[model samples]
Target: MWNRPRFDLKVRLTLRVAAISAACFAAISAYFLVTADRAAHARSDSIAAIVAKSLELQQGKVQWVANPRSDFPNLDPVAAYVMTPGLCLAFRGPGGDMLQRFCSGAPAPANPPPQAFAAFYRSLFDPGREAARPVVVRGTKLGETVVSVDPAVQTAEAWHEAGRLMLALAIALPLLCVLVYAALARALRPTRMIRTGLERIAANDLTTRLPPFDLAELSAIRDVFNHLAQSLDTALAERSELTRKLIALQDEERRHLARELHDEFGQSLAAIRALASSARQTAAQECPSLLSECDGISRTATGMMETLRGALFRLRPPDVEELGLVASLEGLVAGWNGRSRGETRFSIRFDGAFETLPAAVSANLYRIVQEALTNAAKHAGATKVSLELTMRPDEIALAIDDDGRSNEPAAKSGMGLLGMRERVAALRGRLSFEAGPNGGSALRVVIPLEASDRQLLDHAA
Candidate 1:
């Protein structure tokens, strides 16, 4: 089932205004119609009384006994004064026969109201109600005068009045809706800015802030949004600082551990291998059978030494600051290629100068590449890996693409990707890992340079 479409604030408010206006117009029209009905009834009664009084005056002046039917005063003059559109006057003799009747003989209206409206008005007010007055001359009943207003005439008048009101309403309602919608749109225009600010914040731009607004409610929102942005920016800065320090400490600890292992285990293993070789040489001729045992010991010591060297290389990578970022990365790729021994191909592409890069950025970039390469080798089973580092005026970008099995699951759950994220976060950068175009996966990192870095680059250029 489809859900009902929801209108925005401006449209909803305009629609509500229109509804209220229509209701009010209906009420006003009803009241006007009722008032008109009462007025019409009062006018009919007054006309009846006037017509009765005129008849009595005519009776007193003329001799109804002398010529009862022949000399009855003419009611034409009275009808001229009392008769009007939708009105009629009548007089009946004592025998209940009509003696005189006068009507306005008004024509039917050109644009008559609908039958429904006429029926409804008649039902409410009974517009055909007659006002009757009995005429008694000298205690002898003469006739009765009756006056009535036409139902159609009264209904038509009420409809015309209501039509005027509806005409005005029809003309004004659309204008009213347009004005209301415009006012609401102007009032809520700041919402667009708020939305943009929120989008920036979602994109990890903690510095984004909403400016002060003219409306009190919008200003309050601005205050809250700016305060929240400020808090988030401060928190992020503190977190980045903390992460940088932690990473520095970790590198220091690794260096110390690597140094200790090299000094203690490395020296011991070298000594054992040298002693075994010496024993093998001496026993080659002295005992002949002990030669195999001596050779086995030497081989085992050599294998242990090789394993320790690999561990040491990972624990304490070459100093990025001393070796330079480009050289360090090149050496790292070379080391990986040497280890892969034709199983995988590793390559690097440098686009711009990195001599002025910050030490922290350089070190983190080196470590990120190292961890990415390790994941590609162990988890992704990549056969070909390529690294691209570009130093632009505004930002530094690093992309690592490999042709291998997709490592998305391992990337999500592995510590290698997490470490890469932390390093990127510390530099206020973005990290994205997704499937490569051809096959396997691609990792991308972008770190915008600070104002000072940009200025330095400009000066260098």
Candidate 2:
């Protein structure tokens, strides 16, 4: 019966799906960036090797080429064909230094790239883009031609693209999530309506009906929810009617029992007492021992009558039906105070029109207050007990507090509290136990006052 709160369905679904998508996107993006970068590196290396081979075939390049600036310009056609953006073709002298004059299709760097930048870029792309070969033209040796391109620019460009891609994803993920959340909410819109219906049902509105839905699944759910509410309503109505009848029968039975005990056992004891008294008077003149025996019998009869009186009071308080609820509760508390005998101080207060209440209401209130008083006297070890019966315009409130325990009530192990709850619930009332201001326990009960016709209608439905 206890329902703990959980996140909304749309939000939970959106977040879960968004997280999974983000993970998958991240993996795919990394793989794509890596593959694209490797493919670029391989293309650059292939172009460099082609340029070097072309240059080697024409110039007969070998380990050494004398006066390379004057001779290696034959590579202009090869450089024109091979060079692209971020691609640089260079011919290196035998000493392994760039020949800027021979470079074409790209601006030459002012100096050889720093070893550190090359080493880092190589690690990310391809490390072996440098190409060198000996030119053997007609089996004759010539200086070697080396062709190379640095992929650092390509690496920087790849990273820039990656950043742009990440930025796009960052912006789009939320928008996508928002769209998804809206869709989910729309799809589960009936669930929200169903939840509202359930809440109304929880508040005892069995007449609550879910609206028709467009979706078949939602329509089915609505039908089921409506049916369940109807069934519960019917069941609870039957149960309440049964309870009402049982309570009426029980009260009648108690009244009958009380009357029987009072009329039969009460008269028998009274007659025995009168006969014993008369016998004692007659015997006192002739035999004193017989008079003493009559006196003992009279005392025993009086004791039995007293026990029967207590039992009758318990079965049904005599004044409750005669004097009404307020007076009955006051008398009950007065008895409790007397029993406590100054160990616990007691107070009773009533406000508003305390009479004219229905018989069932009066009976339940009386019984519930009786139980509360007995519990306070027998269990609560407080020095001060307070009882209040307040009649508001819409409801009646009863509050009983003691000054014994602090902050918490004693464990409810016995049937007294449970029976009290049942009695209060039978009258369509609310009961609660809380910590009293003075460290004792407070018992509060509220029973709503409905019109007689309305009460009957509710019971019938």
Candidate 3:
């Protein structure tokens, strides 16, 4: 099933880093932005303060130019007036002509201050600008002079610088993000490798190992995966060994049972048959009632012999180990047909190179077929059965099908089915069961001899 993105550690880390980096970048950039304009304004304020002090020194000494019409931008007199104790007024036109338009109101000026002028006028002189110190004017005192300092140029420069800074940040942030992403991915390379290695391990491929990622932080995780792979390999080896022993034990038990049934039970039934024959022969010389009793005894012994024979056949089957899986399956079909009601039909098919199968594979294929047939007869009200043993170059396939109304419960647990699964697992084979067409069941097993080393080894043995 596909899952949506939820809270994951890696994603959370990435988001946190991005947030912090963006916030920090924004804060620093904003600081520069604000300071850029403020510093410009401060320079303007400093110039204004200087102009105001210069004007205060020129309070009443000069005739104050009374609105000068000449547009000669003169700084010398303006600077000189700043040194005196009187109001001083300075002006410059748009053409950069400085004029001392007014002093502190000796009378109204003949020409008013230029309607459009830009200038810096100061009320006092400071020794730093090398102007005359303010001296006491012997005349009447005048009102304080006002100074104006223009900072249009400085303000524009400040804005331009701030724009450049913002532009640089805009251009660089995405690149920074890209670089950070790459560095983080590189730093986390070992973790990705570990994840991939663990995935392969989960898929039961233990032949591959993760490389040594020497990061001290991740060293423990590396060791854990390596240890896990080693443990899995050991477990798989032990499981294969156990499966081998179990198969061998099962073969031995089958052999023991086959021997016991053939030796003890077959002999006892034979002796009983011989005794019954003798009784029949002896009863002929006796009375008619005795002869009838002998016939009943002989008939009972014959039936007993047949039952014992059938039991032995079930216990041992035919020479499956000697003739291989295909012949054994054919024998099984014949036996089933012989025992089934005359109404039931049976068929068997063999495909591929059946003789090339390994013995263990052959055994598993036969047992699967056996279990399938037994299930069909017991649970499916089958009137016809079909079995197939198909071998390919790479795999061995067995299929048993029946044409009958299924009588097995839909979902109840059954040992017969469980045993089939266990047998397939032990052989490292695969089994599938499906409802057959026309209301019956189909059971199949496909064992890949090349894929299962243990099966191959046992078959070689």
Candidate 4:
């Protein structure tokens, strides 16, 4: 299954900061845009009012021309005094009909769109250049003068302000994010260090510990982590020592029992064999029927001795160190196949160099394979099994697959699989059992030459 991508603390923090900054800048930019447009409109209207009022008498006397000129022309005083860009003078009758108009540089519209007037009311506190005033002379309204704020000029101003704001944000955001991320990463560096140390402890490296930290809170955490690691190391050491003593005692007891069985039991069997032989000879003459019974006793005693010898060998397999793991496993598979029933077949394939492996590794791996085969025979109900032994540059791997239906519940609690796991765990390796390719059970083992790169080692702490 695919999983969604997860953002780390740094990424999440940076994105959140950027969002907040953008929101704040957006609000500020909006306010400035509205305020600037209103200021521009008001200033233009005030200028238009003062210029129009100065020409009050001249506008009142203007009469309609008898013949139209080639183009509408401004008188010298009107042109000289009121001619300006986006500003003009219009003389209108009592009925609000235009009579004559004066242009400073460019003529203003007689009536701008309703949209512009609507925008002015909405920005009532800061309306753009939409101003109208009545030109009155001697209490008679001559015409109405209107000035509209140039939309282009207002747009350019807003653009400049917005551009500056955007530029500032663009430069500041990255720098701010970098500063924040660096500070946070440095502040939390202790946590990462502590986590790494815990993983080491989990991997059985009890010596692992967090480094010293500068901040008081982090320093305290580091100290606690170090103490915890120390406690775990001490506990693991004691447990390891106890386990070693117990294993040594167990091995010694096994060897002693084997020795005693050979010395005492072998002698008793030999004495019995001798007594039986003597009885058979006597029986052969005294009672011929008794001779058969005596011969049976001799044969039974021989078989018992043979079984005892095999048991001893099984308790502690011989030629392990001397014959090495490959030869040992070969011997093991041969024995299993010989003893198996129901058309069962077992095979083993070994590859790569095994000369550099530690004796403990070889021995444990041998036991693991032995246990797996035993499971296959007794529990897996397999008809065929195959083992693959391989070596890669960084690791050694062992795989055993059998064509037998698995009993999963039993497999989990099985001593054989448990023992295999214990051995692999001790070696800091990975071991697993699952459904086989041939609809049976598979045992997989991978032991790294060095410590495996896994975060799971943290659990050791």
Considering every candidate listed, which one attains the maximal lDDT?
Answer: 1
Output the better candidate (2/4) by lDDT.
2
Using all chains and alpha carbons, the TM-scores for the candidates as numbered come to 0.82, 0.73, 0.60, 0.63
lDDT of 2 by residue, 76-99 (tens): 777667666445555656555655
lDDT per residue for candidate 3 within 1-461, as digits (tens), equals 99987874555666677778778877875587457545544543453356544444444323366854443333454555343322344443334344344433233333333322212111111111211222123443222223332233323333455456667777776677667777777788788788888787765567657777768778888777788899888887677668767766876787788789778877876787788778778777775567777777767878977887776766667766688767787777887888886666778888766665666667766666776777777667678888777766566677877876555773113666776676676665677777776667777787766656435444654
The candidate maximizing TM-score is 1
Which stretches of candidate 1 lie above 4 Å from their native place? 1-7, 56-75, 90-149, 287-296, 338-348, 380-386, 401-409, 432-442
lDDT against true structure, model 1: 0.88
TM-score of 4: 0.63
Ranking by TM-score: 1, 2, 4, 3
How close to the true structure is residue 241 of candidate 4, measured as C-alpha lDDT? 60
Superposed Cα deviation of residue 39, candidate 1 (Å): 3.2
Model 2 / residue 379 / CA error / Å: 5.2
- What are the Cα lDDT values of the candidates? 0.88, 0.72, 0.61, 0.71
Superposed Cα deviation of residue 31, candidate 4 (Å): 2.7
- Rate residue 84 of model 4 by lDDT: 56
Minimal lDDT window, size 10, model 4: 452-461
